[model samples]
Target: MSADSTRGAPCANCGDYAPFNVGRAGPRSGKMLCDDCADDSVAYIVDCLDCEWSYTCEEPRYNWYHAKIRVQQEGNTHETEQRVFENESHETVWRNE
Candidate 1:
């Protein structure tokens, strides 16, 4: 049998190959997105009500994956934003506000 016949098909977003299964659903059900893409579909953000200290976290669609956070800081009216990727431990470090 061909690769597709045995492993279903490649993902539509990132072209990651996925195997067919009876319990698959959501993106996998339609062969649209891979596990990585599914986990990165939605993003969530939380901000401090007092300061410009805000951070965003991308919600995992299926599995726990590395997600980056965009941290924003306002210093003396000079706004600065930094993009920080999560480490192996899924931790993010920021400067004191």
Candidate 2:
């Protein structure tokens, strides 16, 4: 996602004036968060296996299999879901939920 200029407003989660991005998942959903706090709140990264496309989501009722099915049904093929962990900087490191 693109970073938005907060124009000196502090992050909603961490109170930092750093460059902020909109949080797409977890408790921070819809709120502006600093990069570190945004990364910390993500619970999963849904990716399309056929293309370099992905998004982060954190509905408590949603799981990897559910996300995969939803994505495929929407006409995207071969989607995968990877659980996110705290302090991880890259999606390359994955583990089963």
Candidate 3:
């Protein structure tokens, strides 16, 4: 959750203190991660993962293990495009969006 509005604020990045607001999420967690945090997290994940691959900023915002995916490249193919995997042994129970 985020404030209704964030005016005259500090950059979540450099902390230079400017008019900044929350940024859109990247791969891992889904919260009101600031712009600076988002950038750092992206770089960190990219460097650690060692790939120029893309990601999906889809639903199941707060829980990755139970989220539905919406692909950026709807009509594409790759051997390992799925960023998150599901455990095959568990039976699935769908939830309303």
Candidate 4:
């Protein structure tokens, strides 16, 4: 089958197929994933290089205040760093330096 034939094919992660499902590419593996699988994957991560503060999320949006609150709740007073990654290639899309 040609590449075009696989446009609405079953999701590589869930093996579910639907004509209206416009699957998303897996962030880590590049496999075609259904909406649910894609939304459940870890697409972004926040880490503090100086401390043990870390947070992860699958959504494209990240809450900086929430991350800070988490660090504070953990008694981590170190300066927190924010990092954003793309869902397609897992590349560093943004970083607070």
Candidate 5:
């Protein structure tokens, strides 16, 4: 698709602008956000177009405990980083960094 095609568009994962996004939370993914949010969310997959980055949100926006999230992407697969909510901050901790 042309870059202008998605101009002023929002990413499904990141909560900003880009081609599109995955969705919100739960069994069904949420709508798109933006490139920056996409990077923060930790996608099930990712594809960078131009200098901007686009990514896919996980199936469930949260986790078993119910907190925020952030995944990773390398090539076709996403480097899983399941941050769970816990500790004093009610944060989500993942296996990855």
Candidate 6:
């Protein structure tokens, strides 16, 4: 597909302009997801293995938009960090420093 063809138009997944659905979280990241992709994608929650750092938001199928979440470490300290959910599995956590 031409770069300009998809400029600010249509769903990023299917290239169709009509019948678009907005993904509130995950890979879609609030972008326009076609009805097909929306149907195929699943919702997930992210949690930390070390402490009570669980992500409790309904994002799209495989994307995240956590740019300013307060994460409490094992020591009970708060820190602002950015995180992203990788796919529906939601097993990945990235810290933006």
Against the true structure, what is each candidate's TM-score?
0.29, 0.27, 0.20, 0.29, 0.22, 0.28
Q: Write the per-residue lDDT of candidate 3 for residues 1-97, one digit (tens) a residue.
A: 6655545444333555443343543233433333444444221111112334443333333333233333312212221333324222221222222
**lDDT of the candidates, in the order given:** 0.42, 0.42, 0.33, 0.41, 0.34, 0.40
Model 1 clashing residue pairs (backbone): 39-61
lDDT of 3 at 50: 33
Stretches of candidate 4 off by over 4 Å are 1-7, 20-30, 38-50, 60-97
Mind giving the per-residue lDDT tens digits that candidate 2 earns over 1-97?
8545554356666777644334432333335555555554224455544446555444333133454344334332222222233332323222223
In model 1, which runs have C-alpha deviations exceeding 4 angstroms?
Answer: 1-5, 22-31, 43-97
Candidate 2 whole-model C-alpha lDDT, 0 to 1:
0.42
Error of 6 at 35 (Å): 2.2
RMSD of each: 11.6, 14.9, 12.4, 12.4, 15.5, 11.5
Better of 1 and 5 by lDDT: 1
- Show the lowest summed lDDT stretch of 10 residues, model 3: 41-50
Count of backbone clashes for each model?
1, 0, 1, 0, 29, 6
What shift in Å separates residue 27 of candidate 5 from its native position after superposition?
14
For model 6, what is the error of residue 23's alpha carbon versus the real structure, in angstroms, after optimal superposition? 15
- Model 6 alpha-carbon miss at residue 41, Å: 2.6
Candidate achieving the largest lDDT: 1
Put down candidate 1 lDDT per residue, 1-97, tens digits, no spaces.
4444355567665776755542442354334556556655544444544445556545454322222223322221222223233221222333322
lDDT per residue (tens digit) for residues 37-75 in model 5:
533533253443322334444542333112223333232
